[model samples]
Target chain A: MVEIESMVPIAAVVDLVLGIATLSIISRSQGTSANNRIVGCILGWILVFLGLSYIMTSILEFRYGALADFSAVDRDKVGGTFAFTAKNLLLSSAYMLMVLLPFFFPFRLINREWDLWFLLAGVCVACAVFTAMHLMTNFEHFQVENFLFIPGYVVLISMYIRFIITEARDNDERLRKVSVVVGLVLIGIHGETMTYWLSQVLSINDLFFQRQSIQSGLSISAAAWGGINTRLTLGATAMLVLCAGEAWRSFKVGLSPFGVLTFIIFIIGFVAGLADLAVLDVVRSCYETQCEAFPVAYTIWYDFTSEALVYLYTPILFMFILLHYDIVDTKREENRWLIRIIVILMLLIVSSTILELIQSFLPIPDMISSAALAIVVGIFIGWEERIVKSLIDDSASIQETVPDFALPEIEHDFASPRLFNLVFGGVTAFILIVSLLFTGLGVLG
Target chain B: MSSDDTITSRSLLVTRESRVPTAVALLVTVVMMTVTMVDFVGDLRATDTFTSNTPDWNLTFDVQNYTMQAVETLQDDETRNLEFDMAEVIIPEGYSLGLIDVTITSEEEEGISVQCDSVAGDLIENGLTAQWNSPMSNLSGQDSSCQPIELSLQVYPDFDGRSITVSAVNEYQAMQHWLQDGWGQGVLSVDLELDVNSPLGFDPIGQDTDEEITVDVTVIMFKANISLVE
Candidate 1:
């Protein structure tokens, strides 16, 4: 069986391109409403953070091969390497942005002038604290920052349920738009975990971790293991809640595409849970006997669901939110061509990656697959205008849609895209410098 | 109603319009967070005290051998050779071929006047996936006085012994690394030559003219079994 290729490269390239494209759009929309501008900047920066993190991850994978294929000990053995350390730090930085994103987007919950400072400070403090803790503990406490996701999860989930309830109560289609945005944000953040919902609920995920620990010869501290379980529990709970929320909304106000997306994810989780059960022996092989290779089919299942969600679909989802919701001022005439280019470019790239993945498993001859790719490319090119127009035509900013629900703008002179770029840009440089220094001095690894 | 009381996103959770969903959200988040924090804290405490009960892994090696032997008759001044096709050696599941040994023997009874003719065995490394020139490998063994000459080669690198106890394994253990195909493979040849040193260096009768030679080859295969040290 062909091995599943690494998705870090795909995630890296997609996030970087989409992020830069988004920021460029935001930079040009200087006259937009302050709330939308801030939201766009935050989303853009989140993507950039994720992009840079994935880039570091790609570098690490290139240097030491896939982390999943490595035993835990070997994972740590390479963990001390420059790319590995940089990758984790960069990821933690991305997570910090993700954690703060909910408060800004869909609706700026923390709308005061100083709330902006709090966010900047949160990112800064999180960066310093996490960097110190990881180094002090030799990266053992890296996952500890998972606790930080709780606030974001709580805000997103709460906003989602609240808005959906209001939307149904008022029969206001505008409010449904808000709910959909919140749901998309929820899925974007917790999608991978959501796919493991069944396994997490059944605690089969714990067994898998146990097997990994035993095989890697690494005994994680209770704290670290707890961190892992915490994240899993959050994902599991979020999945259940999402499935419930989506089903209720669909029943109340005919199904939306977002509802269908949630159900599909729910189904994937159900199947994934069964698959995890089917391979219980393989997962427990290390604890009971010796470790065994997971069946190729099981691995392929993971590749399509969890791996694809994280590496491919999440960016697409974000792009949808950006364009569909008019987060980046997509209506402006000058910006139309660029948005169209990004939409088509992202679609093409994601399509090519999926085709490559299918070709890896299916017995399609190279010529046939190439032709299939050509067909996809042709179809996308033919429908490029329609796709871009569909995304841009009905776009309305959250500020414009649910004005009654919006909190009054607390600051007139709000932060600009430049300030965020400058701050996050500095954070990136700092991370790279620290990584280089620690790696050079051999303080890490 | 009050300009100063316009609820921030943080405060809107408990506001009149959203209190119910906010409470439910808080409750769900709280329950999961509490359960997780407890588990994490307990684990953290266990680790900080240096009393972590991380399970000990015990790897027991099940040692077994795969052997092939051929007996040949060599007349005086006869050079007889036997090629042992190592491919015939079947490795059981989870077992790896670790060491290969070739023993060449010549029969020299006390009454026989054929004073153990110079017997030599050469384990020619035709195409074997083994450490052919290992210091432990006696690939070329010669016994002038008819002692069973032995030729040894390690099938895989650093294959010390089949019956080993690996107290710990660090990632995709040597079990996966050491288990490879074509180990101790290829055609192993043992060359035997007999020169009867009769009482006067002459054999009137052909009694001392012919000798029976035994070429014995053994392949040691090993499998690993793991148990918790606790």
Candidate 2:
């Protein structure tokens, strides 16, 4: 019963609330700009709307359960079982967006100094597209939704990539960067899974549009994502090691008791997020029972991505706070060492970006996209303005006249030929080519 | 483009201001829509569940007769002592009742009578005939419309150990009346246990009242027209 209930959309309400609360907390922390706050508020509204839908759908599910066991039903009642299921899934996704938007609400892009209502208006357009997708999904007009929603989703992803690259980097720390990378990767995986699911639902009655080749590609892409998860986790483990250094650095003189608690919670959240992804994989498998091996695996990978993102909530929130407060500096001498570590991260990001592009054409796995994104963020931490250098430097300056630590001195002769970035970049590119060749057979064919 | 030029520790943090992506994303969205349209239009008439001209049948079975002996007590065990030495059963031909083979015996006689009946005519017109010439008999005969037979044996044995064997090779129609005693495949699997009346009065035997005679009848049928479907 608990499993079934958990599967239901009811928990989405709690997620929405938590998401909104996190934003509020970020806002109250005082460093966030007004533009950031507005973005957050809009996202919060979206979350609330999504949460309501989840709650409504959950209630509808309850009604369905009640009616199913009975021998009789109302004669006039229309739009039967499929309608209900579609409604739940559609509304739940809209609510999922609600739950998701606040976490990475593109606030910095909207500025008090500049009139960016056009951008805000763009947000409105994205929301409208999302809402349309939601409606089409609920009505089971899957192909139509895919035709519409994929573009909407792609647009959203591109905007987010730009947003993160521009606004988020300034104050990033290794830990926060790791969290963002992991979160975005998870998001990408979710998108891919959604795409696969949509494609299947759409292809139910159609054969001539049988993109068997695309299907084959998606399968391999999903598997590649699985391989990437192992890599990402390894990257995360490296980040955790770096975080340990951060903890040690802050432990003696600068650490607040609350900060330590938050850090611990963040670790817990990361672990929880990983577990959630595993669970989501199982859920995806359940739905993809009839699908071939590769597609099923890919679907599962996509599921893992979403679940991981959702579960990584606390850590992501805490890391954001830490970045905002200048507690963990990404560009600090210790943080600069992460460049060697995050080469794999960069590789993951680049590979994923390529895969994402290819998948747009041939339906490659989303996990790859996520891995690429994660790696990108992982690499980005070394240079991110908002998270690693700016905020941390500002905070460090407040405590003591800290030196400009943007560029760290290399202690070893090995630093002259920095291979970390190169290796990661090369590997990521190689993976992208491999994935493309496998999925986009036209490339290999 | 440079790895160091991008990324942030705060990048993991989803800002309250994180707005939805627009321009670049919208263009991608439009392209995806186009692809979807092309796919849809291309497969306009092809659906999953299409079918034609194949008879769908499922395998199943039918249950028939189920029965048990009505009364086992109505049985007789006194074996009749007959002196018949020669007996013959004749089955008509052209009416195809298949093989009509039979055997006859007498308890008192050292050599029992046996014979094979091979007659030719329509069974409905000529009927089945069994003839016997016995050297020893107290009195004699019985006859039926389907099979005309006149032969009888008298007096029960003292110990009641006397045995009589009747054998025949017959087709389904020849044994139709007897088969009616038990019908259908499942029900006919077990042999019928019936009471056979003892021949009249040879009294005053010892109280070894275990007077029961069992005769096993094995009929090998050659042909049966079984109409399975209606």
Candidate 3:
């Protein structure tokens, strides 16, 4: 059982890589807009950050030395050690943000279909509910609370698969459908990572069992890798796919001369990273005795010039580009406020990314997951219709650029969201306030 | 539809939804009351099995020194027979082990030594009876009768904690058969009723009968021997 369980994270890593490649191929074949492609890129880097975070934190610290401030005591702690005390808390919060960030796409974008939105909402809710169970599990009588998370796995997996099968059909905009499918795969893998997190918490005592103790460490590493790697890989691939597709489509439609070159550069950079990862695996395995060699090679080839390595500056670079794009395009100005909101939401996404980086190994509370869900709901209540219509319009633009293609017919038929937005905003604000009271007042969180 | 009419309809719908909790509460109350009544009826017919009105019969233990040693050893061995001195055994009711301790001072010159040894378990021919051998005769002076002795058996039962009772007992009638014709004739009979209750300090014979005897038998102590019911 120990040896088998030790292979779980390896399997998860393989699945994550496959899932990312699938997204890349699907996006390349189907095509998507520039914005969705950008979101996909952000998500891809986030996953890589998650995977690396898991690896770094897994390096056990066994050193104990005299402290300058307290000479009598040694500070080093044994076993699975973290660079920072709050690493798990941060990673958990990041995974939660990933689970929720999709709900913010404006109404025009989501107008293509409601199932995708519902599935995303359902996954967010499941994440939040599981998070609540995780928090409640801190109670001494943890059985019932821990048991609640099992059902969440079923719900999330089923929802993701449902979203995948339904969106796989060749009907509407293939790029959007591919984005949704990739998103589902990422979500599915992330959800599985959550199952592993819950298993760790529930099986902590079981570690003493001969079979479990040996596998526990490896299982922890694998789960963490599965979680963060899938997010980063799939997230980055989707972004590159959507962005390259956008630039290529624009070029095909006679938009720009340099669009094809930009598209090729993005694809080559992505493929190069994939190749480097494969090479890194071989070298790291062979030089297992020389610990510093892999890190040195990784820093040079994989970490330094990696396409998704820009995620280190993701929070800043993505916003700068978005704001810059808004200036160059007039229609982007009409949606400039929405774009800024996206930037803020992306900032929150980055927070989850940072959290995920730390979460690579440990867990944070479910409250953070809840906050992310509230943000998602607020996004949906605020912008689903606009996002859907924009995607649909972008799709229609492929066939013709006539006046009738200006907007879809049901834009007017969709219910006015003023009431919904107000309610959603009110509820979100209330929840935020309550969370603040709980955490800040030292009552509960 | 007019704005006022729409507002009125919305208010009515709100009122209807609000009544749901109240309806649920009422249903819960009715169900709870019915459950209580059913439980109350069920408890009324439950039977009482642990109490009874009949008095209990008890057997007390007392032995001479030699018998006490043998019985104490037999207590540990479940299959061993507890040997006892049959001549020394004294049952407290009408039955006794052997001839009662009797003294007869003859007022004649000639003295006859009469001994009876027929009080053995194997000599009993029927329930509660023992055939006897004695130098005596019937009222017609036939050879089938034996000389009878006017012997009185004193019975003392140990009752501790009011644990023993002899209900519907006739101690006088049980003792009056000592002067039957075959037993003794032309002998002055002085019936001495003995009542000995050591623990309770209540003597039924001493309270009922006014007969006085020259010798007195006092019960010195009473102790209980308790065992598990099985």
Candidate 4:
């Protein structure tokens, strides 16, 4: 029997490739406007940090068998293994980036000028405090520190909603529909987190238990349930459906072939990942009594396939952003050829996943399936290189232009600069001092 | 210019004054906050009970003693057995019994061991049996065994003003081969201890009574077994 531990390295390598591709694409495209640059750079770093975190986590899990059973108290008293500590540090950094990137992305988008030094400093201090807390105590023990990250993301989503609503109000009927759909998709993606935060504030277990009870009623195992609940899976699925609807509407109104192709790839990846999770959920739920009788290798394959699909959606989103922002405008002929290549690569990835799923049921070796996936990924990397080269070559001749994003002008009261600085500085310093005092007390105790 | 550009320019020209959406958002947020606050307050109130309504009392068992003789019959069967009252529990007037518990402890000497596999009482049908190996060995004075048994009583109206009498039996039988070999001899001393407790309590969600009272009773038992050679 093949151990699940051996699969981690392959997964890590795949994530590493994805991270490199994202960074490479963002770097090569070097947005024509300041706002685009800020958004692209922040998002690219977010991807890099998240990818590194996952790679580290996978390596730790591979070496330690599985760290799921270890408690925070166990990690603290024993000082954890070196692999575990490094993994925690990377994960903490990833979470810190996750919170920071969203705030900056929206701020840069809304304000043409990037002059939020004080806000950036506050965020930096908060992230530093969180990192320290996570290091001193394990993630499980630092619930307060984990929770502090939520408000930033919540504010980010709220800003996006406000932007969408404003755009919907001002735009034409077609654009309005698209804006509303995207707004709903954003809400759906962030709904679970909002519900969780509300439940925590209300001190109600029922809010959490309701989801558990529904899963239990369906007889879904915890692992399958977790896959369904994961933010990446849920968010990607919602976005894929919404984007497909938008694409259909765009087609009726005559959209570019490139837009249709992007949506098609997005839909295919989402469906493939969702189908994998659904099949696993059904099989595991139905055979709850005899789940162990099911083949372990197939389970691992499904897990990897679902995870890869979810991760693949990130790059696809980045591509959508690039296209939407008009940062990487391809010539019509080149765009058509690139679209064809993308469609083919997407099909290859989907087929590879389906084949893996089938091999789990049949007594077949995975060598061919693995090779097919690797070859497709290699082709994908080469295709990405071609696009990057094109984008770079095109960028040199194209002059930077003013961004077209509109901001609603509103009259509001304003505090004097000196007063604002004094108050903000005082509050931030007080918070920092209190945090340091508590941390020192904790260490001494 | 595109339709998007036209809409943007038009929107920019008009001084946007619509507040319906903003009002709606604020209203929703306020309602949600109010509901959460109410729930938290309700939880706080539920936990702040200064005194409990349930009645609490303890019943102790007194010590008692008995003797038994083991005699071989014509069939060559040697047996000895004795039964005695362990405790009597009475519920106070206008009060109901919420729970009843009986505890038993036994000890014996090196040559003989005492085991109580079952107990019988008025409140319980037949008796409760030890679900495990509950023999008490007195070979060492430091070793003794105690078991707590809960009487399964019907809920509500059935347990009102109820009185229960409890009893247990200790039996010793010599091996037929030992009797046939004429090896039965000497006296075996066994000590038994018992305690009964019943609390007359009012259900928070159920029927309430004005009177709250406590009753305590104690009982004990001692037994000796004699093995005589025929």
- lDDT, candidate 3, B11-124, per-residue tens: 211233224432333343234324432432232111011011122334343322111111111111122222222334333433322222232111111112121111101111
lDDT at A94 for candidate 1?
Answer: 83
Writing each residue's lDDT as its tens digit, candidate 2 over B1-230 gives 12334323232222333333334334433444345444444433221111111122221212121112211121233323312111111212211121121222111111122111111111110111211122332122221111222222211111111222222212222223222211111111111122222223222442222212222111112222322121
What lDDT tens digits, residue by residue, belong to model 4 across residues A1-445?
1223332344344344444443444344432344344444444444444455456556545554443311111232223444444444444444444555544343332242323443345445665675566545433233233333434434433433343345444543323322432333243223323223322333342222222222222212222223223332223323333344346545454454444543554544444444434444333332221222224543454344433344444444444444444433333344544434443454454455445655655656668667767887777576766654453343321112212433432211221233333433343344345434544455422
How are the candidates ranked when ordered by DockQ, highest leading?
A: 1, 2, 4, 3
Global lDDT for candidate 3?
A: 0.29
DockQ of each: 0.18, 0.05, 0.00, 0.02
Comparing 1 and 2 on lDDT, the stronger one: 1
- Candidates ranked by lDDT, best first? 1, 4, 2, 3
Report the C-alpha lDDT of model 1 over A1-445, residue by residue, as the tens digit. 2346877788899999999999999989977777777777778878888898888777766766545632122454475777777777888888888888888887788666788888888998899888888877778766777777888888877777777776777678887888788888988888888898888766567666666555452436665676677777778788887788889888888888888988999999999999999999887666545678998878777877898898899999999999988888887899999998888888888888888788778877878878998999899999998988888898888878867667887654647888888888888888888888888888876
The alpha-carbon deviation from the true structure for residue B52 of candidate 1, after best TM-score superposition, in angstroms, is 11
Candidate lDDT scores, in order, read 0.76, 0.31, 0.29, 0.35
lDDT tens readout by residue for model 2, A92-123: 33433433333233323221232334333444
What DockQ does candidate 1 score?
0.18
Candidate 4: CAPRI quality band? incorrect
Clashing pairs in 1: A72-A216, A80-A445, A222-B43
Best by DockQ: 1
Better of 3 and 4 by TM-score: 4
List runs of model 2 lying over 4 Å from the truth.
A1-10, A20-32, A60-138, A142-445, B1-47, B50-230
Instruction: Report the poorest 10 consecutive residues by lDDT, candidate 4 chain B.
Output: B169-178
In the order shown, the candidates' Cα RMSDs to the true structure are 6.2, 22.9, 29.6, 18.6
